[model samples]
Target: MDIGSEYLKIVIKRFKEAKVTAEKAIEQLTESELFWAPNEESNSVAIIVKHMSGNMVSRWTDFLITDGEKPFRNRDDEFMGDIQTKEQMMELWEIGWNTFLNGLKSIEEEQLLKTITIRNEPHSVMQAIERQMYHYSYHIGQIIYVAKFLKSSDWKTLTIPRKK
Candidate 1:
């Protein structure tokens, strides 16, 4: 395959891995634990998931033709910790990932060099993909950290154990 095709495949794989890692961490938490924040200033796992899902939906829907920051997206509201149940949180997560993954899969090799706008700022398709990948990775790390803290002694290793 050409480099562009290879790159797309690799990005998809990495995104999937990130999603699974976050979900594994999330699975270890109770519903109440998902909404636990260390302090008033910090966000709960639920808030992070809400923000990530909102971001994904806004950035991925009509990704090429429209600006990534959709007019309807209320980024501020995503941090409000509105997700009340595990089912609701998972639903939002599925919607966001489905929109993003489907959009990513639809890109053609030639489109990689094309410019797109996010909040009216120009970015090459490659740059946009890289940008979201980093953003999601950062949030997923937060989710994992919070899960580890909440689970304490019960936390299962998502990867190889520290000593192993």
Candidate 2:
């Protein structure tokens, strides 16, 4: 088997699937619901979206040429939930996802073995991609959870509905 090609295909497929699930979950939330939190320490969907967008844009913007943690990123502010509306959140989300997907598409099979840095920690390109994939998926799960909690019985499932 062509391992590199198979790996690339699998990563791309998983990224697309994750994005679809997150978007579907977001669709069930209204503007108010997007910013609701269960407690002071908990994150709202808006905050999670902000953090994910910030992380994606920072990590992927100059992905191969520089460290994944961009100097200009204000990581702390991402949790503040300052995004005033769903439109703002969606715009940021689209920008971040586009940056990430485009960056991923630009990688060549040979480049996967090249080393990259995130917060000065060295990682292969494949490792970095995998890291972000897991990170984004984790936060997306949180977004779905918060949205579902806010929507209560009205929440729509992003995947196959439970068979009762």
Candidate 3:
């Protein structure tokens, strides 16, 4: 079976757009700013990316053969802001992005129809894509929002809508 290139293309495009947003947000941040959590219970952007990496790697690596939520995912520690440096956070993002993109590039048409189990719940491959897209975009929005708050007057607008 063949997963049509068109569908994969759309999914990849959305994912890339989110990556662009994340990069822009990070670029606006200083090293000290990355560690600033709004409150004691909140996470910084660094913490979010670390969690994203954990989610992506577990959910995508050997994706079809393994459970989406891996035994290795430390869901509780994600809020710890464990990635204390810019280098480490970016490296985690790279790892997650590479793993996810590679998996998307290889998805088979058969897999698109096959029911895949995520945390014991079954979903078609397309649904999984939708789920992850929403998940990532939600977090991307958080990154952008926090960056803007930190920037205040210095922030540049990122997704200007084109009036048609």
- The 10-residue segment of model 2 with minimum total lDDT is 143-152
- Find the candidate with the highest TM-score and give its number: 1
Give the alpha carbon lDDT tens digit for every residue of 1-164 in model 1: 69999999999999999999999999999999999999999999999999999999999999899999999999999989777899999999999999999999999999998999999999999999999999999999999999999999999999999989
Higher-ranked by TM-score: 1 or 3: 1
With candidate 2 superimposed using the best TM-score fit, by how many Å does residue 86's alpha carbon deviate from the native? Answer: 0.5
Best by lDDT: 1
Deviation of model 1 at 57, angstroms:
0.5
Clashes of 2: 0
- Any runs in candidate 3 off by more than 4 Å, and if so which? 1-3, 161-164
Give the per-residue Cα lDDT of candidate 1 at 1. Answer: 64
- How many pairs collide in each candidate, listed in order? 0, 0, 2
What tens digits encode model 3's per-residue C-alpha lDDT throughout 86-147? 99999999999999989888897667877887898988888988899999888888888899
Candidate 2 per-residue C-alpha lDDT over 1-164 given as tens digits, one digit per residue, 9 for 90 to 100: 88887898889889989989998889988778888887899888888888888999999988888998998999999988689999999999999899999989888999999999999999999999889888988998898888787778998887778993
Model 1 weakest lDDT span, ten residues long: 78-87
List TM-score per model, in order. 0.98, 0.95, 0.92
